[model samples]
Target: MIGIADYLDKQLRDYGIKEDLSILDFGCGQGNYTIPIAQIVGGNGKVYVIDKDKTKLNQLLVIAKKVKVDKTIEILESEGQFDFDLSSESVDLVMLFNVSCCIIGQDNYPEFQKLIHELHRLTKKDGKLIIGIKEGKTMLNRVETGIPLISKEFKLDKKEKGKYLDGEKLRNGIFYSLTKK
Candidate 1:
């Protein structure tokens, strides 16, 4: 968790995720990134986290409580569906770090499209999306090198390669920042 916060604080700053901005951590698994996000965003900023794994969500809450960031963190439990409860153009940043294969990869392309469309709908016009993909993900091997085909709804503004938390250990990966088109 220590390295995660330091990494996120530096990475998120590039995306304008300072205090008082709203963020939605979609597909937030076990909240390895959520706790650090909560701290970075602080009390005024809201971190809305969504994950289908109830058990992991619960564990995240316990961790948040220990960090005294539970009040700033909001959980949106999913039912293995992309139908989120957030409103359109409501969030300043969408954190898709450590996303699952179900929403990415060639085989899950349809689901990937749906996920992007939904995330696009939820992101503010000026909001930024940061998606991190580890090596070996199906999409990472795509002809475009895992770059999403999102030019229609979002514009790929920046790409970064650095160390990110994959579960707990730090791993080198690529992440992109996309702004709504």
Candidate 2:
């Protein structure tokens, strides 16, 4: 049986997460994508993972060390808000997979959009941003309303059928690859 990390790393490579690129996994929880992405990016690259949850951050650190990819990652703790201290336009890729889809409802959509705008600040002029939204035709806060606000902050470069990390499983979702406009 394929473990969750192995499965996710394969999915990430298939989705074209390249090597030697600095990345930010915002709201990173428990090293799901953080560990695999760190491995993919290798020794020359870095994955800056930020999460408000201490437990999750600690768990992720443990996993990273166990996987021998801890050197490629820089773990950070936040106050569970939109604010960040990273320098502007520092990373090659920014990933918000499975982070925005949950809280974006009929209301507070603006707040979610604000987060996207902040991401825009963190992305390099030629860098890419990736998001994974759950598959749905009618838009349960995933398809319809989410993209427009994000479009304001990023240009849709490409999209691929991919899985987002959900707990110990990889769930069905679409990965949107966007670049600055």
What is the alpha-carbon lDDT of model 2 when measured against the actual structure? 0.79
| RMSD vs true structure, all candidates | 2.4, 2.4
lDDT for model 1: 0.78
Error of 2 at 76 (Å): 2.9
- What residue pairs are clashing in model 1? none
TM-score of 1: 0.89
Which stretch of 10 consecutive residues in model 2 shows the poorest summed lDDT? 136-145
TM-score leader: 1
Q: Model 2 over residues 84-151: C-alpha lDDT tens digits?
A: 88889888888877666554755568778888787788888877887777777643445456777778
* Tens digits of lDDT, candidate 1, 1-181: 4555676678667667788788999888788778878888899989999988899999999989998999989987589788788789888999887674546555666677778889889998878888877765454664133345667888789877777787657888777788888
Off by over 4 Å in 1: 1-4, 137-139, 142-148
